[model samples]
Target: MTASPLLRSYDDGRLSLPNRIVMAPMTRGRADDVSAVPHPLTREYYAQRAGAGLIVTEGLWADPLGKGGPGIPGLVTDAHVAGWREVTDAVHAAGGRIFAQLWHVGRMTHPVTLPDGELPLAPSPVRIEHQQIFTKDGWLDHVTPRAMTTAEAEATIAAFAAEARNAVRAGFDGVEVHGANGYLVQQFLAENTNRRTDRFGGSLTRRLRFAVEVVEAVVAEVGAERVGLRISPDNPENEIAEEDAQGTYRTLVDTLAPLGLAYLHIIERGAYPALADLRPRWPGTLIANFNGPQPTTREAGEKVLNAGLADLFSYGRLFIANPDLPTRFAADAPLNPIRENLIYGGDAEGYTDYPALTPTPVG
Candidate 1:
């Protein structure tokens, strides 16, 4: 059989991607909870999966207050920086390119995870209902978050900028702003979560201001060519609701189009045809992902590629189960099943212990 297009090299003048298969970010809660630092095995886990064209690491909190749960790795303290540096070095030594995903869970956080039991900060006092936040103690009811003062919001933007620099210092090739998955950025975008009347919210432009500013600040710290943004327009994950999903996201993409970003990674499982609409609108590289009960398969990604909808495609759970994902895709090798119970808060039993069929090429 001929080699699939998914395995072909892509050089777009900016990102010289070796293949279209991107190892999407998946949060594996295995960090040092108290220190918010990654363990040594984290390095081996990443290095073992270096066959992917690019690896967008699991979301890490840029600020101490940005942490959403236990074992969430951080870039805030010096210890955090050193821990991540080792992970980056391992991936690099294996000849792989990696991007740090800067994340802030915002109101998804519980007071139990916060400093001194302070309320989580969000665009407004909105809290997610129906779902509860899982903490170290146990499952806790989502509490109403404190509305972030305008000054605090500005400071948060700077914190992302600072961490972008920190990621570079740790040897990351680029940084992706985690604007998707109903986190802080999406909270500001969604009308139900953002009830602020200040410049950060109220209208379309205002609603997108926080996300746009965060991206711009990070781009300034790094370069536009080294920055990427992820978004899930109509995805109601974490109880987020966007009344005008199309308009809200259209304006956001159009606004950020001219910045010459490295790429725009989007989750395509929204209620609307978000990927179909935004693919043509975005002028830069486009990375597409589909979310569901099962892990993303090569067949699903091929459909997107054949439709001319995306330049790259990403896999989440598949990467976790099969460390040599690109090689397995090439050989049509059977993949290892994911251990649901050992996915989070575990040792090497589920993480670095996953066996690879054979060694994969670095590039």
Candidate 2:
């Protein structure tokens, strides 16, 4: 049988991937509750999935206030560096490359999730409607986040740059800016959440200013070769409302075209056709995460790759259960089911306990 196009070797100068399958980043809250350091089991979890061409780590908060949940890891302190260094070392030792997805949840966070009892900050004092936030206590109502001051906005940009440097120091192959899924960066892009008239809001260009600046700062710190940006393009996730997603994101891509970053990751579903609009605009390596069923089949992935829409396909829940996902795809093997209950804030049961494919004896 011929090899699947999804498993093709791709080398675009910067990222020399063994295959085109990317293990998409998912926020599995498996860190120390207080310090927000990655659990020791996290290393084993990633190491076991070394078969993936690339692994984008779960969103690691860039600062203490950036944390949006109970057990997500951070990249702020020396302890964070130490903890992540262990994961990076384990991945590299097993011949796998990984990128840290730098995240700051902005208004997506609650006071309980934050270190201090202070309100979460965002582009404006707008509360995300029709959504609930999960924290240490339990699911709680969303609150109107405090508007970030101009000085605070600038500090946030600097914080992202600092986190990029820290990620490199921890021996990460690269860093992915979490500009998607209604985080701090996306909050600045969406109209409903960003009701400010400051330089970071209002006009289309101004509303895009914060996200551009965040990417620019990170690129400046760690060279564009080691940076990637992820965007949801009007995705209503986290109750974000982007009325002009196509215009905003098209301009965003055109504006950042000269940076020559590693790649642009777009989260797409039925609501909007991402590749149809954004693919022609992006000339570099483009990764398209087609949010379909839990276990994204190889047939579905190859169809997109064969259609020439994306350079790589990212899988989330599929990788959770199938550690050797690429191998499974290669062998056309059956996959284990996911333990939905143990998906978050748990020990290695639902994590590193998933078995890899056992090698069959040669006749």
Candidate 3:
């Protein structure tokens, strides 16, 4: 694969990338809640993928009340910091730069996942339809959420900012706000989900306030160059809307334009057109996740890079399969297949078992 000049090192603001491939943050519930720490397996997991130019860790909960599932990790305590430090140290030692992805489930929660069986809060009191969330016992469907008052919204932003401070202390190089996939922040961004008549909802600019505030607050805690925002403009998972997709995201992207964030990650699916328009609309780095369940092939990634559709491309399953994904792409080597089952729960069976390719002996 030929390296496009566009794929060369990226350095403008405080952001820097030696290559154009980033390992997208993936959730593998391998943390121990008793200690609330990242397991040794988690350390090995990141170390294996150190070849990617950049790695984004699975979403780390900002507060226990915001946790969505069992076995998820958090950045609220000292133990959590130490555990994450191990993961970051391992990544750095193996020549990788990593960022912690901050998350809050918002209404995508159940009583079982909360600290004391409290109902999760949302912009409105509406219950999500046909959505399942992980609990300490098992999977439970989402419940009707209580609407947050002005005070609650202010508290939520402070929580996110606190987590940003913790992320840097945890030794992560940066942080990505998990404002996608219909989670807490994205829930506010979608008008259909956000029915509040207050300043947080009602209008496009109002609906976009939560997401922008999260980014702005986190950037204030950290630096704009160390912050990235992820969005899935049209995905309806968790009963989110695809309506007004263009208007919603244009407001978001343009609002964030002046912040000069490290990158804007848009998961490709129902928002390709909107994402394409963002290339010129956004002055900072833009990362486009390739379409499809299967990982983007080297050819496809190269096409995206050469065309300048994105400043970088983020890969999920491919990074799982090829720990040395950057080298594999560089050498045009065949990739190992990843087991889908191990993609979520379980131990290291398929998690850290994938091996890098070694050259065959000449006969």
lDDT value, candidate 2, whole model: 0.91
Q: Top model by lDDT, which number? A: 1
Q: Write the per-residue lDDT of candidate 3 for residues 1-363, one digit (tens) a residue.
A: 755442467766566767778898888877775555777799899998887778999998987778877678899898898889999999999888999999998998788878778989988987887757777777777788999997898799899999999999989999999988888998898877899998898888888898899999999999998899998888776788858888788878888999889889988677447567678889988887865767677777677777888888888888887888887776767889888877766788888888887867899
Q: Kindly report which residue stretches of model 1 are placed more than 4 angstroms away from their true locations once superposed.
A: 358-363
Worst 10 residues of 1 by lDDT: 1-10
lDDT of 2 by residue, 213-249 (tens): 9999999999999999999986877888889788888
lDDT of 1 by residue, 98-164 (tens): 9999999999999888888888999999978899998999999999999999999999999999999
Which model is ahead, 1 or 3, in terms of TM-score?
A: 1
- In model 1, what is the error at residue 356, expressed in angstroms? 0.6
Question: Model 2 has how many clashing residue pairs?
Answer: 0
Model 3 spans > 4 angstroms off: 1-7, 359-363
- Give candidate 2's error at residue 207 in angstroms: 0.4
Q: Whole-model lDDT, candidate 1?
A: 0.92
For each candidate, give its TM-score against the true structure. Answer: 0.98, 0.98, 0.94
> Quick one: ranking by lDDT, best first?
1, 2, 3
